[model samples]
Target: MKTLYLVRHAKSSWKFDVIDHERPLNERGLEDGPKMAAHIAAIMPKPDLLMSSDALRAKTTAVFFAKAFTIPDTEIKLNHKMYDFEGRDLVEVIKSVGDEVDTLMVFGHNNAMTNFVNSYGDLRVDNVATAAFTAITFEIHSWQDLIPGKTIYHKAPKEL
Candidate 1:
């Protein structure tokens, strides 16, 4: 079985004058991001591969999970495509994952995260809050052949 954990970037600060891609996490995100990452790590197995969008907010959120999993910086991949708000780019990235990876953690934006979970996971999630962690287990052998899978786990900041 392959397990995919999807995490939406922690809440970002609109207070910045920078572009959307450069927006940093707000105070709440800093506090909740690590907590949620550590909480999830305590329950589930560590990811074989950890990836994140190049966007500052997403990358920062991924760092929390990487630390919790004890994943080295060299092993973490930063992808530009994941910066997509739409789910298509994210889908392509996931489908392209090598078979060697049985577990994967992805940090990205929403509408994409929410849409992916709703479409690919059995559970119907109305929204994926900032720093929310959602896991889906697939019975398929390859990431290329994705089907609707069961939502094995889900946790948000407020739920913590």
Candidate 2:
């Protein structure tokens, strides 16, 4: 079985003069990112791979989880494809994952995250809030054969 963990990037600050991709996390985002990461670390297994959008907000949010998971900087991969908001690129990224990876974690934006999770998981979530985490297990052996299995867990920062 393969386990997939989907994390929505933390709330970003629009107050910055930077472009959307370069915008950093807001105050609430900084607080919630670590909080949610710590909460998930207590329950979930360490991921075999960690992937995140190259965008600043997503990368910053991922850093918290990386610390919590004790994942080295070299182990975390930043992908421009994951920056997609439609979730199609996200799906492509998932399908490309090697079988050697048993558990995979990805941090990105939403409604893509929400759409992706609801598409393959048994659970139906209206939205994936910032710093939200969702885990789903697939019965298939290959990432290319992804099919709905079980919605193992879902956690939002506010719920922590």
Candidate 3:
């Protein structure tokens, strides 16, 4: 079985005069990131691979989970493709995951994250909020065959 963790990046700060990719997390996001990360850590198994978008907000959100999982910073893989707003790139990235890794965690933006989860998982979610986490377990042995799977959990900061 293959487990996939889909995490939406924390709320971003518009306070800074920066590009969308460079905007950092807001105050509420900072608080929520760790909270949500710890919440997920309690239930999900340690992932074989941790990946995140290279964008500032996404990367910051990923750091919270990395800390909670005791995963080293160097071990976290930052991928430019994960910066996708459309689910296509996200799907491509997921499908490309090495077969050796049974579990994977991915931090990215929405509606990409939300679309991916809803499209591939059994559960239908209205939205994947900031610092939101959704886990899906696939019965297939290969990442390439990403059929619809069970939605194990979907947790957000507000829900916690």
What's the TM for model 3? Answer: 0.98
lDDT of 1 by residue, 1-160 (tens): 8899999999999997999999999999999999998999899999999989999999999999999988875687999999989899999999999999999999999999999999999988899999999999999999999888999998899998
Q: Which ten residues in a row have the lowest lDDT in candidate 3?
A: 67-76
Query: Listing every candidate in turn, what is its Cα RMSD in Å to the true structure after a full C-alpha superposition?
Result: 0.7, 0.7, 0.7
Output the lDDT of residue 125, model 1: 87
Output the lDDT of residue 96, model 3.
96
lDDT of each: 0.94, 0.93, 0.93
Model 1: ten consecutive residues of lowest lDDT: 67-76
| lDDT winner | 1
The TM-scores of all predictions, comma-separated, are 0.98, 0.98, 0.98
Write the residue-wise lDDT of candidate 2 on 31-137 in tens digits: 99999999998899999999999999999988999999898756789999999898999999999999999999999999789899888899999999999999999
Assess the local accuracy of residue 155 in candidate 1 as a C-alpha lDDT between 0 and 100.
Answer: 86
Count steric clashes of candidate 1. 0
